[model samples]
Target: MIPSTTASAAALELASAYQSPSLQSHSHRVFIWAAAYAREHDIAYDAELLFVAAMLHDIGLVPEFDNHTLSFEEAAGHIARVFATGAGWPAARRDRLAEVIVRHMWPEVDATTDPEGHLISRAAALDIAGKNPDDFTPAFRAEVLAKHPRLNLVEEFLTCFKSQATRKPTSSAARAINSNLDSRMLTNPLDAN
Candidate 1:
């Protein structure tokens, strides 16, 4: 079984490797929201594991492959293998997070069997439904409310949106991604004469 510590590190590594600053920030926000939701609802889950899984759930975003027809089981299994091998995570914990990630994409599947799995799945759904970067109108609010009734996600998102004005992206991270891009461009400058 993959160690929990290893799983945590793998999640952190995935977050660090994300290319888009906006996407990374969104990932961070989703994790925070998930954690908050868990506490708010008095849901019993391994908060650390759930948070890690939620944060890194979309690591596949880097490749941007079309897996529309892929079953959640397959996608989750692939993610588990990827984390285990790519991040040196152990098999057991990777499998756990894999279950969470896979089931998250398809909520119709049974979710109550595992606490962490349920939380992560719900958190990801809430995140996707509330992805209005600019506006969250009444229709959007109603949609999220109806779609993710467990967490009262729409209400929480309202709270989150109001508070977002106080938050800003980390400048250091922005600089790091930019520096990495600059180095890559220097090495393979398409416009170089």
Candidate 2:
């Protein structure tokens, strides 16, 4: 079961406040996917931290909190750290949470160092790009998407990433867009009409 702590609740509230409906749904799907992956793989992790990290991984994309100069991942990491610190999380915990948020954007993450980071990274790719649909049963995917429908997520995600790329040309999102936006955008299994 996904753990619910005060910090995790606060993270959800912040995500709701900043994320668009599509993005909010996406965040929830990320959590569901990550948790499901953990359960299926028998990977022990802190569910509360994973929940918070998955929910707020895209917080930097929110216009109100975004610093145009920094990559969205970096900005989101700083914001998550600030939120965790305000919630009285220990420095180590806050740093770990920040690492989870920051690393979600990476193409790959080493699970040994940060299992939460690795799971969230894999889960986000699965959610966004349909990278490993076979890992989760079709029933699991149906259940998750039924609870939080995509709401035209592919288009919404591309638009958001395009905006970020435009503002921060050197950002990871920009590099990704330049490299293969169309292929990634086209790969979402949920978007099939």
Candidate 3:
């Protein structure tokens, strides 16, 4: 189940206000995907923390929160930290929230150390690039898409990454472009199916 918490609700609200509907839906699906993966792997995770991180993990990509210098994930981490602090989370928990968001962009995260981070990283990859589509059944995938349709996400996200790459050539977004992220996204099986 999606975590029910004041902070979690607020995170969704924040993303709704600043992000496109496509992006907002993607954020919610991130949590759902992560939660499912956690269950499949028997990984213990903080639901509320993971939910909140998923809701705001792409906040940096929203034009309102987009940074002039910081990479998008770094900007997202900072935003999550500030949001968590306002929610009355302890400093360490706030740090963890930020760390989880930033870690989504990383290639790997040890679940034993940061279950939330590992789930988010894997789930975000699944959603964005269609990695591990077999991890969830076809019916489950259909239901997810029915509830949160792609709604032009492929177009919007690719454009966002291109813009991000031009402004921040050293950023992961740029690296993704160099690594043919566009082709992977365009040919993503999820979008096709």
Candidate 4:
């Protein structure tokens, strides 16, 4: 079964309230992709934790929470940590989840050091940029996307990242926006044929 818990549900609720419909859909796709990848590769992962991480990964992009002082990843990590703490997650697990959220913005993550983090990072990369689009079977990708359609994700993400980069030019989001916004926005992963 897809991993879920009270904590994960709460995270999803928070995200749904604050995030756009497109972003919420994207977040769900991230979880689906991560879980599917873990299953296909025979990699063990905590579904509940991955669910929470994927759902709240973009919480910092929410306008009410975005202060433009910290990087979006850092802000999102802080939000997730607070939620995890209130949900009675132990420090170690909470920290791991936070790391997963923060590291999702990395250009690449080493799976050896933090498998969950790496999975989420790669999943977000796949959803946002279509990186390694062929890593999974075409049917698997189709199933995930069918459940959580893109909803014009490329334009939505570009708009979000551009706003963040414009507001916080020194942040990692800005760096990423400057470097990858063009390619990512232009290329549609679902269009692979």
Models ranked on TM-score: 3, 2, 4, 1
Writing each residue's lDDT as its tens digit, candidate 4 over 1-193 gives: 4455788778888888999988999999888888878878878888898899999998888888786688888999998998999999999988988899999988788777777788899888888877888888888888877778887777877887888889899987789777876687578567553
- lDDT per prediction? 0.48, 0.86, 0.91, 0.84
Clashes of each: 5, 0, 0, 0
Tens digits of per-residue lDDT for model 2, 135-175: 88777788888889889778877887888889889998898
User: Which regions in candidate 3 have their CA more than 4 angstroms from the true location?
Assistant: none
Cα lDDT, model 3, residue 66? 96
lDDT of 4: 0.84
Residues 1-193 of candidate 1: C-alpha lDDT, one tens digit per residue: 1125765666666666752444454455455555555566666666556756665665543434213444323443476567656666577866876777665555443434776766665655445443222233355444434432333323332333223222322322233233443343333211121
Q: Who wins the lDDT comparison?
A: 3
Model 3, 1-193: lDDT tens digits are: 7678899888888888999999988998899999999999899999999999999999999889999999999999999999999999999999999999999999889999999999999999989988888999988988888998888998999999999999999999999888898888887777866
Of models 3 and 4, which has the larger TM-score? 3
TM-score of each: 0.52, 0.95, 0.98, 0.93
- What pairs collide in candidate 3? none
Let me know the TM-score candidate 2 reaches against the reference structure: 0.95
Model 3 TM-score relative to the real fold: 0.98
